[model samples]
Target: MTKIIKSGSGKELADARGRLAPFLRDTLVGLNYAYYEPPGAQMLHNNAIFVRSHDYSEALSTEGEQPWKTPRLVSSGGTHLAGSLADLPYALAWVEQDFIVPESVQSLIWEDLVPSLLTGAVLPRWWRVTGNELHAVTLYQRAGEELLTASAKDEKLRQMVIDILSDRMLPQRSGRLEKALRAGRLDQVFPQIMPADTFYLASEFRRRFPNDAEHWGPAGKELDDLCHRFASEVSPERLSQDFGVPHPALAHSYSRELLNVKPFPTFQDYSSRLLAESWDSNNLYWARLTDEMGYPPVMLNRLVPQLTRRMVEKLFATNLDDWPAILRAMQETGEEFRLGKTASLPKSEATPGP
Candidate 1:
């Protein structure tokens, strides 16, 4: 199914031999798998099998004077597997194996066992059996665009795609979000985008850890605890109904924002826009948007703390002149913050207890 004699330079052929394990070197002697250079004079046939590197440098290390076979094989690519070993870097061993092992047992090793050892194979049955949505989301990300595109076409992938979105467990952009939109299943996806508890969890995460660095304690045990607690409290049907789904307009706007539809404007305008949108639309209009589009309060509050000095500088400058005045206005009065429209802080309504 694949060409046995691929063309390569004689030097390249030599370099490939240098990388081979001693066991492989000894076993695969006199195998001229490559077509040499110099107009094909006397064929300087290399006595070693050369395969295209599939990041197998460690596997081919000669520390033990043998090919570095893994003790237990696990797929690096989660559920991504090629149709054949001939399609993989393992193809170098295909012809070579026949020389060492008998033909009768070759298919058993090359076809069945070797493919299982390579990446793109499904996760272990135990891992799948655990039914951890987070793990599934990880696998989905590792699968990358190939899995995502396939999800649009394949029924199993489509179902898995829906499940991933429905879980709403992934914090990062996992392409499941985009896939749901493209597949015209936003209705299924949007309702669960921010689970009811997500508002609390996201808010708590933001509140308890203003500095992002503090939240990540030694492999993220601190964050994991919060996530575990949130997971325990999540009830898909109940929370979806409580939080409610966004309107078509809000969903479209939010999705566009996530996908970054428009290019970023000039520094000041961008900064002003972010502050205005976050505080005005999200904070000041939280109640209104919740009523209008079923937006969670978390959406309103999440960006407030993010409007730091560093964020401003990253956009353009060290500081925007208007930011201090804006911050002062926000702190002084819990009202819509706009430039040059100052309002006195309103008095609190409290009845005196006699």
Candidate 2:
């Protein structure tokens, strides 16, 4: 007669321990278990033991000098035992009293007990737990799939996974990311690049501190004026030389007009171009680019306010000779030309208010 033998719980436990033993060994190595020795130069070399007491009468109480009068002993000692000697004093009282529980069985009990004891009344946040678990499982599955699927094929997917992991783990700052994005370098390098969620978060932060514009110092107002001039049909190359490279989109928008148009471009046209191109009317990109191009903030700060007025007059003047005259008039009058503030000029003749 043929008989079938069923695998017992002990067999299952053994299989689990076989899998977890390597990780446990690694953890022990990390904890410097090899160098660890008890106070009396006693080396722990045996399997872990666990003891349960139903009542205080069954539990052994110990103190001071020799906590365990009788040292715990395990059946067939190999490595270290990981249990309190006092808790299992009955088993320790006599080596013959202790029975061998499979390492797998011990591990299973430890796995349950540790989490149960550590996990108190409060549970980890659901999102955090889910994210960590999902990330781990995802990476594991991906690695397994890559190994299996790419064995007979090209190594593109495997390489991609490696690259992604390396890049994701690399230390990168969002400020640098923002700088790249704003300069359009990210889009240039990776054509499909989209602005990160961090950009919107930065925008929100700027919104919260609107007065940060004031702290931009003199450079901020100069950048605004330069952007206004560039948007109003001023030659981008000249502006680029004088101020800096206008934003690609902004420069493109301004260059669409006839080669030589008189009276330059209106502030309304400049404002419209800025709005249409989605460039920040208040926070111009040219100044940022100038700074990125290695111009010192302090020098740019001093130059920008003066340079914007010069560039505006240079662009708006009917003839090149008119610049000296306009500059002379500006020098004579305390009022700015852009603001239509001249000492001799009448209030009625000034540029109309919005």
Candidate 3:
């Protein structure tokens, strides 16, 4: 039996305190749960219930900058909070299935479709813009994921999605990997060190030593090709190929198999699955950054714009006579600013708010 749970302004929230009481009472009784509603605005006293939650502390807010942007449930025993947007029903379904929860509930929440409207509350402009390559990489990966999920029906389309996703995702780790390579960690730790400086070092090495190519053979050549391709584009198949593994049949299976958890199954089933999952992961990362790193959203936001401006300024400052070289450097710097580490500015310079 599909249990229909309807939530909205008219049916979910009412002006009469007495009349509004029973619906909450009934919802809790029907689901074997308890309910809570935050205080309404005093001025209009319009009975605008800002938030609602189950007895277990599963919360849903209708107020604040990013109201519906936050989780509906902060799992009591878990570190992660479960949030959903109406735009990404497939993601909600994936979560429900992965968690072994009732898909009915997932459908119900989505049918209510409160999150889509909440975008007005938590606008994209609220996402603080900056030149952080990591953020750019993340955005690219997200956009790629969306593209992939939406293209999943076709094999060629899936491959294309995987290619773009993998490519953008790779450069995100370049700063750290490059640093490690420079520090000679790869030579000491990795079984065989490639002559190249970064993640695709093996490819560079293979390129330089075609005679030794027989040693690595088809597998090595494939890996080298995969890595080189990643420098330009990426996808689940490419990611799997790079890891010398097969792509997973199941969607969103990151743990049981690394290759399986490509976020979107075929790269065409966008239906909100990837976005919801990605947003959950991103929110958790952001939450940790706030809790552990002491970097609040406001502070993080202020830092990015300034850092981007500074990076742009520095590109112009370098005294270079060659016009083409200068232009190339500027373009590279801009790309770096768009997709690199220098996106985060010092905390001291972070603005509080407008």
How much lDDT does each candidate structure score? 0.28, 0.27, 0.29
lDDT of 3 by residue, 207-264 (tens): 4444544334333444445545554343322322222211112233322112222222
RMSD of 1: 27.2
> What's the candidate order when arranged by decreasing TM-score?
3, 1, 2
Error of 2 at 315 (Å): 86
> Considering every candidate listed, which one attains the maximal lDDT?
3
| Candidate 1 residue-wise lDDT, 1-354, digit = tens | 012125667776666666656547434431222311111111122321122222233334424333333222223533122122222322332222223322122221212211211110111111111223222222212222233344555665455544443333343333556566467564544433321222333333334444543323222343344335655332222222222222112232211111112111224423433322222111212222222232223332222222211111122122343222333322322223222122322222332111
Model 2, backbone clash pairs (residues 3+ apart or across chains), number: 2
lDDT assessment of candidate 2: 0.27
CA shift of 137, model 2, Å: 1.7
Q: Which portions of model 1 show Cα errors greater than 4 Å?
A: 1-223, 232-275, 278-321, 334-354
Candidate closer to the true structure by TM-score (higher is better), 1 or 3: 3
Q: Write the per-residue lDDT of candidate 2 for residues 1-354, one digit (tens) a residue.
A: 011124447666677778777667556543432232211112223423222111122224322243333234333333223333322212221231122222222221111111111111011112222222222222222222322233223344333322332231222332343334445353332221111111222222233444434322232334334435543322232322222212222344222111111112224324322322231110122133223333333333333333322222322234322222222322222225334443332233322221
Off by over 4 Å in 3: 1-260, 263-270, 278-280, 292-354
TM-score of predicted structure 2: 0.15
Better of 1 and 2 by TM-score: 1
